[model samples]
Structures are given as C-alpha cells and as structure tokens.
Target: MINNSKILLVYTGGTIGMIKDFETGALRPFNFDELLQSIPELKLLDHEIETVSFENPIDSSNMNPEYYLKIAEIIEESYETYDGFVILHGSDTMSYSSSALSFMFENLNKPIIFTGSQLPIGDLRTDAKENLITSIQLAGLKKNGKNVLSEVGLYFEYKLYRANRTTKINAEHFQAFSSLNYPALAESGVHLDINEAMIKKANRRKKLIVHKELDNNIMVLKLFPGINENIINQLISAKGLKGIVLETYGSGNACNEDWFINLLDKAIKNGILIVNVTQCIGGSVVMGHYATSTRLEEIGVISGKDITTESAVAKMMYLLPKELSSKVFKTIFETSLRGEML
Candidate 1:
C-alpha cells in the first residue's frame, strides 16, 4: 500500500464548483478551500486533499491554450508533492481540454482526472457531489505501492475514459461524456470495477516532460452535400492556415468532382497538410475504399483511422510547426500516438 498520497484538486471553473444562493437561487463559485463543508464525505477518503483555483474563473467556452499552460505549470510546480490531480472544468469543452492535456504531459506517471457535473454542486439533485467524490477516490487509488491510473482520464457518471478519446455527448443527462473508440478504464457501481488491461501503464522512471509548443494555424473543413468551390476556397485560403482536417463522407469519401479534387490538390501542393477523417460516428477513415475516396489517397491525403475529432485537433496542434517534413507529418498523424488512433 502507498503511504502519504496527496491529491490536488484544481478548480478551473465549472458547475461542479458552484453553489446556489439560498435567497437569489442563483449559482456562484463555492470556496474550494471549504470543500469539506460542502462535501463532508471527502473526509472519508484515504489521502490528503488540497485545493487550487484560477484567479478569475472563466467558463470553459473561454478556455484556451494559455489556461492549459497554467494547468501544466500548476502540475509541474507540485509534481513531486502530489500523487495525482483532479481538475474541475465545464462540461462543454471538457473533452477538448482533456485531449490537449494528454498531449501536453508526455510520459505522465500520475492520474490527471478531469470531471464536472451537469448541475451546480449546491443543488439537492446535483450530480457534482458524486462525481467530485469519486474523482478524488480514483486519484488516490494505488496498487503495489504506486499510482493505479497513470495517464490523463475523464471520469463521469459511471465510467472512466482516456482523456484523448472522450467526447461530451449529453447536455441534460448526468452521463455527459463517451469514449467512441476505446473502453472505460474504470466503472463506478457497487465498487470501482477497474478494467486493468485497459488502463495505460506509465514508465515511472521517465522524468515528466511538458510540451508547451502548440501550433493553432489549422482549420477543419467538414464536407456537406452541394458544397461549392467558394466555400472550400474560403476555408483553404484562410490566412496562415497550415493544416486542414477534411471531414469526409462515409469511409473518407467526398465529391469525386474535379473541382473538389483540384482544390484539395492545390492546398496540398501549397504545403498545407490535409488529413482525411470519416464523418461517421463509429468507423475508421478507410482511404481508397471506393472510387470516391481513391482520389484523396492518390492526391496524398493522410488517413486518420478511428480517431475522433477532438483527438485529431489535439494531434494536429501538437504536431504542426514542429521540425517534421510533410512526409513525416503524414506518417505520424496516421500512426497511433498515445493510443488516440487504432
């Protein structure tokens, strides 16, 4: 058994940290330092708990890379002091932030669990208390004197998912996130049934390396019926656009029209990396599957097989502007990094 495990609770603004005013019936930020007062059950946990918050809590819609860096800095500053971290963030962009964090921390050896609730924590029927309580439990979990969850994860409702593979699927339901291409690492029911085989094993000997350089000069071009050249051109011609995520039809197919191919080819020739991903909810992007997709493969478009949009964006942001050649970029994007793509 591990001794003296410390879990840091980073509150970056979300419904999970809000309390409803009795008089006005409005939600406001609760004092995270007073966590025990709000959730007395936290005292039952087996580890020391600490709290940190953003100076000015912004909604998740306003979340950006700067805030991401701030989180990384906090983790870096307390890396040796804490065994794990639980981040409270808004559900709307939780997946995006989690995905970004997965790429930011290389070779992580501790849990960085992101969680939030659909309702404010102060509400009687709110799901925040359970999520917060379980997240803390998961963060402090250990086996053989080491941390159990050593990678970035999202724990919600009853499932714990790899951060990069998750997406927020519900606005009104308690289970707001889903992992489309992966299995849950752990499930909370009568007990925390951990899928030990599914959990990512970390190399504890490796020192933590934080990657802060992210290239954001990229655009997502989603294909739709009757999409004209003008619309395509506008997206491709965006200033300083260095990469494009071509959200294609089934099996990575798009309009076989020469106009479309020419536009894509020109973008490729101009040194803009184009990646083809399926728009379907649950299928791999299989380039060259049909005549519709053959042109994309022939024109040097890379396939992002079985990767979700959130992972694709995070991968691109982490990869682009690096010293990689076009050929190398395609190879890496198609290859599985951190099990984001199968």
Candidate 2:
C-alpha cells in the first residue's frame, strides 16, 4: 500500500456532507472535523487524508460555471501539494461539474474523482461511506511510482467511469450515474479491478495549464414531434447565446424541414456553434447516415459523435472563451480533445 500518498478531499456540498439530526430527524451539514468519527474505516486507509469544504454548500441544481472555475482553482493551487483530489459533489449535476473540470485542465497528471450519494451520509443504509472510502482509495492508487489515474473520473456503485462520458441516469436509485457510450475505467467487488487499457495516459512532461475563463452562454434544445419554428427561432436569436447542444432524434436525425434547416443554418452563419448529439442514452451520432442528418452535416453543424450532452455543454463552454475561429472550433469540437468522443 502507498501509505505515503496524500489526498485532498473537497466537499463542495451534497448528500455526502449531510447528517441527520438524531433529535429532530432533520438533515444538517456536518463539519469535516467529524468526518473521521462518522467513517472510522477511513482511518484504516494507508493514505494521508485532508479535507476542505465550500463556505456555503449548494444544491447540485444550482451549480454553474463560476463554481466550476472555483473547483478548478482549488486543484490548481494545490496541484503540486497533493497526489490526488476526491470531490464530494451533488450527484444531480456531478457529471456536468466533472465534465467541465475535465476540459478546464490540460496535461492533468493526477486523479480528480467526483462522488456523492443518493442518501444522506447519516442514513442507516446510505451509500456515502462506501463511495467516499473507495473514491479515496482509487485516488491514491499508484503504479510505477506514479498516479494510476491521470484524468477526471466519477466513482459510484462499485464503478469508476470517465467523468465526461457519464450522465446521471436515475435520481432515486443508489446507482445513479451511467456511462452508456464508454466502459468502466475501474470496478470494485471482492477486489479492486482496473481496466488498464481504458485509462487515458497523461503527458507528465508538460506543465498543467488550468483555464479560468468559461463561457456559459449556452443552452440545450431537444427535438420532438410537433416541435415548431417559433420556439426554435426564439432560442436561436436569444441575446448572448453562444452555443447550442441540439438533442436530435436517433443517430442525430432532425426535422429536416426547410424551416428547421434554415434556422440552424442561420445560427451557425451568425457565429453560434451547434453540436448535434443524440437523444438516446446510448449510440453515436453518425451524420449523413440518414438523409435527415445529411443537411446538418452540409450546414456546418458539428457532430457530437458519442459524447453526452453534459460533455458537449462543458466542452462548448471551455472552448468558447478561447476565441478560436469558426473553422478551428469545428475541427477541435469534432476531434476528441479529452477522450470525450470516439
């Protein structure tokens, strides 16, 4: 065991940090000082564990790019001091935050594992203890004297997935997240098993560059039967809109109507980036596979391939502030910048 490894546990507010008050039966936030008391098993782990929490813990639904930048700055400031980071975030928007972090950092050489539970940590059958403990263990994993994981990851329900490839599938279930288009990077059962071939290798020679600026002037538009032009036009013409994640039908098929095509074309022509991702939980967007999607490809709509909407949004936000030209942006978005797409 690598007992010498040091890990920073960042509690950014979620069910994992909540404890039920025995007297009132009301849930209240617990200080990290008592973390050892609640989860005594953590003391058994060989690695050194330290914790930090947000001044005002927030619900995951309230998460935004500003908080995303805050998380990145925390890791950036302590990048060299700690071997790894374990973030306790709300499961609802965990994927979004994790995906955003994945793109905000370049040449990352340590694991940034995000985790949270469906139930409060004080609940009798809560999954918080297991999730918290295993995440720390994974973060501290070392091979050849180097960190085993070099990319952002989310660990839950005995599985660790590439953060950008994951989505919250169920709110009520203990197993809340899924990476439909990607495989688990690691799985826990009787033994800790890691898929060595699936991990993203980092360029350790390069210095880590943390990007602070993120543009959130984006929105997701889902296509459905009987969708009209009025709504679409309003969104496209909305002031300050920079990008759109169009959740199209199977395999990125859209309405294909002249009105639909013209609206999207106008958006792209006006410098708005449109990313075509599928509404299905699993499957890649193969533009031009169908006649409906063909026009989208011809109109300069970037194919999201197998990337999730969560990732597409984060990638868009990360890329927008760079001020890349339309041509450069299209090429980079289509390309797998962080192993987000095939």
Candidate 3:
C-alpha cells in the first residue's frame, strides 16, 4: 500500500465501467461514486484515488484517433498533479489505445497502466474488481522515491505487459491479451512480482512532451494466399493516404507477382510509407530473409521487426503527421521509441 500517492482513474468506457442495476438488471455507466461503492476494496487501498470518465461512454469498437487525442489531453492536463494514471478502457481496443498513447507521450516518467475486464464489473464472477484494484495499486507503486513503472503497460488477468507489445487474443477468457514477443513486466499472485530488469525506466531529466497530432490516413493490408491484385490497387489509391501497414507472411514475405510489387512501388514513389509487419501474432518481420520478401526490402519497405499490428498501426498514425522524409521515417519506424519493438 503506497501511502499519500495520488492515482487518477480515467474511464473511457468498457465492460469494466458498467454495473448492472439490481432492480432492473440493466447495465449503466458506473460513476466514480458508485464505483467506490461497488468495489469497497478500493477504499482499503492507501492511495488517494480520483476518477474522470467520458461523458458518453462508448464501446471499444468506437475508439479512434479523435478519442485517442481526447484521452491524451486528459492525461496531459493532469500530468503534473497526479502520480500515475490507470485507464479503464474496453479490452477490444485497449492494445491500440494504449499503443497510441505510448507514442503520444514522450519522456513520460509515470505509470500509465491500461486495463479492463471481459465481463461487466457488476457480474457475480467479474474480473473487474481485481483488474481495477491491482491497476491502481501498480499505478501507485514506488521504489526509493521513484515510480516503479514509467512506460505504458497493459495489466490483465494478473500479468502486466508493455502496452504496445500486446494484442487481445481471446474474446471469452479472463486472459484476453498476450504479449508474445516480449516478457511480462509484472505478475500478480500472492505478491505483485515486478520484473525490474524488464521495466522501461524513464529519463526523468527530461520533461514530458505530449504529441497531439496524429494522422489516421493509413490502412492495414493483410496479405493472404490469394489476395486479389485489384484490392491492392484500390487500397493504394485511397485519397490522401499517407501510410500502409502491410501485414506480410512469415518473416515479412508477400505476393511475388510483378503487379503486386509495382502497385506498392508506385505508392512509395508517391510518398506513402509502407511498413512490413509480420501477420503472425508472435514473430519478427525479417525482410529479405526469404526470396519472397527480398524485393520488399529492396523497394524501401520499412521492417516492423517484432511489432504487433496494433502497435504498427498506432505508430504509423503517430508518425504520419510528423512529415519526416521517407528515409528518416523508415529509420525511426524501425527503431524502438517506447519499447514497442525489439
């Protein structure tokens, strides 16, 4: 129990933020007051907890760049006042939202833990209470006068992972997310065990710089065995398109057809940055590793390394508005900014 630490809970709507009305059995948004009442254990935690929520709670499917900006604004405005932040978001898009925020904040020196539950908070066997409680506890964690976690993390079913390194893999299980490429930062059991060696320590010497400009003029094109050429042609021609996350096959291989290569080549020449990320959930994109992928590397395709598609999309959105040159963007995209990649 960290005493005197202030933890801010930002509820941007999710099953975790819903409580069933006992009388009518209808789910309604749980206000901060009712939140305390529903989970009395929150009161037992020694930290000073404050909460803010979206006026109109929305499902995770409705999450977008605009909402990402809104969430960042909330944290930016209160960054100096709070010790840490725990965002209660829908698990469906938690990885994306968390990844986007990881890039939005530069040089963050405080915990930003994103968490939500598969079941509503009001359910009898809900996992919400534990998720919410432990997230707050993690957010308030401190060691030798410094915050324990300084990067964006996603905590669920007792495991804490770097936010951008995560993906929601299950729909019905309590453990709905997984970070296959990276190890868990912490695990909750009899004791909250944190992997100090794995944590991303913040550079406190630098002040936090929040980046609010995000361009969503990007699309993710997942390649399959028989993905049509016309589909590729139309997608590249999307108006004002700035980037594309090409979800390639094993080790970033894609269709070897000349038409496929030419279409992408044209897009790159027209100033669209295409990043080659592995479609497989748990591996790195090593472009040029295979004969099929050799041309992708030769044609200026940026390798996403081991980044998750969610993070790749978030990274693309974050970088698109920066107006970096094709070469510089490739260098930066391939490099790790927030521990999002290897």
RMSD of each: 1.3, 0.9, 1.1
Question: Taking the tens digit of each residue's C-alpha lDDT, what string does model 2 give over 117-199?
Answer: 98889899999999999999999999778998999999999999999999999989999999999999999999889999999
lDDT of 1 by residue, 218-267 (tens): 88889899889998988898889999988998889999899999999999
lDDT (10s digit) by residue, model 3, range 120-211: 88889999999999999999898877898998999999999999999999999999999999999999999999999999988999989999
Model 2, TM vs. native: 0.98
lDDT of 3: 0.92
Count the clashes in each prediction: 0, 0, 0
lDDT of 1 at 158: 79
How much lDDT does each candidate structure score?
0.89, 0.94, 0.92
Each model's TM-score, in the order given?
Answer: 0.97, 0.98, 0.98
Residue 75 accuracy (lDDT) in model 3:
95
The Cα RMSD of model 3 versus the native structure comes to 1.1
The whole-model C-alpha lDDT of candidate 2 against the native structure comes to 0.94
Lowest summed lDDT window (length 10), candidate 2: 1-10
**Which numbered prediction scores highest in TM-score against the true structure?**
2
Poorest stretch of ten by lDDT in candidate 3: 30-39
User: Which model scores highest in lDDT?
Assistant: 2
- Model 1 regions lying over 4 Å from their true place: 1-4
